[model samples]
Target chain A: MNKSLSMLENHPHIWRAREQSQQEERFSLGFDQLDEALNGGISTSGVIRIRTLTGIGELSLFKHVISKQRTHKMIAFVNPPGDIQAPWLATFGIDVKQVLIVKPSTEKESLWATEQCLKSTACHCVILWSNGVNTKESRRLQVAATHNDALCLLFTRPNRNSMHNSAALQTLPISLDLCLNYRQHALEVSVLKQRHGWPKDSIAIHNDWTPNNRAIKWAVEHNKVKRHVLHSVS
Target chain B: MLWAYLYFHQITLDTHEKASLSVGNNSRYDTKNEARHKRTGESANGQHQPGKTQTPAVIVYCEKTNHIVQRNNGALQQGIEIGHGLAQAGALCPQVCIIPFSEEDERLTLVQLAHRLYPFVSDIVIDTHNTLAIRLDNLVHYYGGHKELWSTITHELNLSKVSYHFATAWSIEAARILALNGVDNYECDRDNIKHRLSQCSLSLTALDKKTKEALTRVGIRHVHQLLAMPVHELGRRFDNNTISYLTALRGETFPHVTLFRPAEHFEHFTLLPFDVENTQHLTPFMEKLLGYLAHYLRARNLQTSTLCFQIDFREHPSTQLEIKSALPQSTVDSWLSLLTLRIENEVLPEPAVSITLRCDNFETIEGSNGDFFSNRFNEVAQKQLIGRLNAKLGEECTFQPKVSDTHQFETMSNAEISSSISASTFTSDIVPTFLFDTPKPLTQSTKVCFGPVRLHSEWWHETPRKRDYFIAQTLYGVRMLIFKDEDNQWWAQGLFS
Candidate 1:
């Protein structure tokens, strides 16, 4: 057998293995601890589900991901819970002009709009608010988000007490599932599901209120004294 | 200095017929008769109605005198002649249709023709009469040669079924003279301009009737005979105006005509062969007009921010639809897509007889510097998305979110997005990504994370607010911006990651 012919035969086999590994590559979430726990930040080809209570910093975390990425593509918000406050988003270093908000009137429309935005080359990240979306729609969105090298972040309320497993917990389709809850003045993020990695214990990120904290403390003390005097007079 | 003059013969009559053809298969004679009956309140009696016997007929009207000016072959056979009054023509040939002349439609038709020819030639001069003289020297090579260019022009005219007389010469004045004198097709070369123009009759010159009669009395029947006279003697006899006219006619001097400058705004209208009942049928026409508009914009290096479509109905008044873009666009495909979206959403009130597309809002595009990795493609893609979304949903729906400088959560505004956000205005602040419309009351179990910021203002309100804001964490492991009012009521205002 000729040495060159044998090497050529092995070339395609090597290329196929490399291509398979490339498909499994992940995108860093810009948090080293979170990335370490998830093996990578999240797979670039699958959906990331964050199940939490309504007012926790889920949107802020998504904004963190967007601001950290170097891409210039737009970030789309589909069926947000309320009117997106531009000033609030700007405070997080997320460009307000680069954000596109779609307020769909119905659940079907919300799903459609999200799918369209996810597939469009115009959007690099699509943040969807999924409250009552069915499992079928979630699977469809997961496929669309993974079709290109864009990120799809799904935020939903936690189904903590459901007897049947929720879509967020069912890891058949999603690449990563995170459960975020606030505890003891900190944000606690725990990996509930990972495609090819072990789940790590919850990581606590301490909240920093700074500069404003002193003013709030002073105001609280001042208000307490005023309330005491008013109560005594009454 | 090669110039081409196009004369639309019987423009008024042709426009009327074309308008009739657009509305339906009914002839212009029938529509005019019907209109006349409606105005005069004359019932369609057997004797009052023309064409009752199904015979070929013609009717010409004089606008100034409101009478018949000329008769066609059919009416001539029936003893109707020039200068016959409307009633007199009708009595003479009871079967001939007499319709009033519409000078407005004629003028509009001429303008439409000029717009169609503007792309081929830049220097177009429309005379008081229905003649359009265009400088064709620059365009001959583009169309392969003089013959090819003339053939292309004639082909377009034939497609529109327009009756025109075409003549070319070294000067616009000579071309206009030859075209107005019923020259269907003629071109004068540089060396033959004098000899060819000399053969033209004196009636074709720009001289007044009195001057023409005086020349004829002096036995000067041909332009060559007039040119034979000494220039000084001719000027002494007929004044300097005639001498200058002859100079221009002989191609010795350029014609002193007002050079036609296209309007800053664009308007192109076409009469449809049949009434369009649905918008889908108008796609081809709309696409062609958009192509013309794109060419016009590209020629001037301009782009339009807005476009309007006016749909003229056969019976009812026309309706107008306006389409706007988020950014200046000169691409035909972008405009066509937007137009398609709008047309799909629109329902016509009546069948359309004609359509006029107009755009007035234009902007000059600044040339972008080319780079190996420029963000131009991304910017274009983003604009395309905005255009599509706005076309489908509506304007003001797709917007960029910006932070407002206010302490109240509800008062934070989301302004409509334009082309781009100013980079200098983006500053980092300590605010959450999602702010609730109305803050939610928090339970006592919610733990305080970090905040105790005090925001107290709006004293002018009926109930001034005094609140202490906090960065709190809920049991669900989410960070929130919580505030407590003076009443000691705690509410969650926004979310943090």
Candidate 2:
């Protein structure tokens, strides 16, 4: 019985329902409802695909998660849709030294750079803003992310002239596929697919989550006051 | 100090041999040369007679003396001697390639060899263009002993594939003289060196011809005979220079060299044994050049951000290709990948006879005494990733973004108009991460989530701008940074992405 227990403990492929533990460390989404719906939260490593139109609260949805990944210093931006301003990244508590911007001349180079950044140990988060990625390229990126134990986020904008079909997106070797949309004062997030899990219906996050907005400051103040009250009572 | 000296007997001839031997294997586009080859009664396929291909056709001729100063093994086997003229070389080996001896070229080859041995022996002096003297007293301990140090030196020299004669002695002069005269031995004991030094002819010493002849007249032919004479008598008979020379050779006085300090920057020039035209034919030479650079950087514990390659052709103007990196990089594989990519895009105007690698800036990193094979990512791996990207895409394509000091935003993301106004005009707080290159016309019916804030450019600007910016959301909840220009027209500035 002890030998079998040791084997179960050592093997990464085996999952235990009683322990409520994951194969890899999971990062909380900072929302109670969202965390429950997604089983625990986002994974610590592996590829995550986000499909949405530009200019919504797409990046803001993950801004909290990016700052949470403090294990490795670098956060690469490969072929971002636009210039990711230094002050903006700083506003989100990202150090200027941690930002590596790569503007590849071609789509192939963009894919290559994404893979290279995912494999580099100095980088904890690699955000690639690609028009689209094929199944083969996504598989390579996933492997690189797993080897370095870092998060690789592939951001794609769905539009009229989309290159790949829904079939290609379905077969991508990714841990999660989340679609984001911004509605008045809320973000509509729906889990399209997740590893070893079921798809979830869309949920409107009623809280204001826009970066550089008043809600973030309000939340900070609220947390400070709550901490002070608890300390005074103790 | 115990010193080891190396004499490159014929570096020029050896290099020439290696070049010719490699380029002769398969050349397909030489019909014009074939006509000339027929006139010279040679094979059209570049193949030599069964036994005649033993060495590269090499001869270094001195125009001043009208004689062959050096010859390769092929020329030696063909019975050409040192005093042979062009006519004699032609008669001995009809296919022998004769090149005029150049003092500058020979000196460059010597300096290149010295660079290879710099890491092994720190205190070294380029005694002459063709000879080097290295102080091994300090390095002997690091390498375990004199034998091990000598083995390391010989190992590096053998990699260069040059004909060299080396010896170790109590003094630099003795070692140099012994090496130049082909007294090849590794017994570095002081007594053994002195015994060998005693047998060298007086003519092998650096003494002036007038002094050597004068000493010969007195029957002092060998070193031992010269040493047997009284110093006072010798000083009385010889000039001050001769006595100092004797004192230095005897180890009583030391000669100081400028010390071959590996230069702050790297500059290595390689002359091909044969002119090469195709890109495929040049990778080997480039690899060898980069190998030398890698060794050079490792010895000095240096990293370079930018390095250039200069290619010289026979008639066309030479061109240079410069490869730059965002971070200081030092490694053979990293630089080779970048150089090969750059060479792929470059078009050679003419066949290149020589190539020179030059680096102007070097950063000396600290605490570099680490593992040679560790692959953990750090500054090295980061630089490698950036370097590969820059080489394939372009240099400016990869960079760390920095905010402009002016703080004024651009109408478009990439096309930032630098001549902007003060930072005080844009402090309203709600800004977006992504901006359009040019303001797009607002086609969507939007709801204003924030108030209109007035914005203006510097008054001194040629086209001063006045606008009202607002944070707005469209019907689909896609938030945008929009503005109203002086024309009362609405435009979308950027995305909240």
Using TM-score as the measure, the top candidate is 2
TM, every model? 0.47, 0.50
**Candidates in order, interface RMSD in Å:** 3.3, 4.1
TM-score of 2: 0.50
The runs of at least 3 residues in candidate 2 whose Cα sits more than 4 Å from the true structure, single-residue gaps closed, are A1-234, B18-53, B277-284, B294-305, B313-318, B324-351, B363-497
lDDT for A109 (candidate 1):
69
Q: Which ten residues in a row have the lowest lDDT in candidate 1 chain B?
A: B37-46
lDDT accuracy of residue B244 in candidate 2: 85
Docking quality class, candidate 2: incorrect
Write the residue-wise lDDT of candidate 2 on A71-175 in tens digits. Answer: 335889999987776656766667766678898878898998888888767788899988668887888888889888789888887543544567434557688
Residues B314-404, model 2: lDDT tens digits: 7999898889887677888888888788788777888787888888888876556343333333777677777777787788888875555
Q: What is the DockQ of each candidate?
A: 0.28, 0.23
Q: What is the Cα-based lDDT of residue B45 in candidate 2?
A: 30
Give one digit per residue, the lDDT tens place, for model 1 in B199-266.
78989878989899999998999877987887888877887777788787767886677877767798
By DockQ, who's the top model here?
Answer: 1
What digit string (tens of lDDT, one per residue) describes model 1 on residues A1-234? 699978987785334322333446566756677777866667765577888876656655555467766446788888777676666656666666688998766777667777777776778788878766666777888788878567788788787776375644555466677888777667778888766666766787654422235666778888775345544855
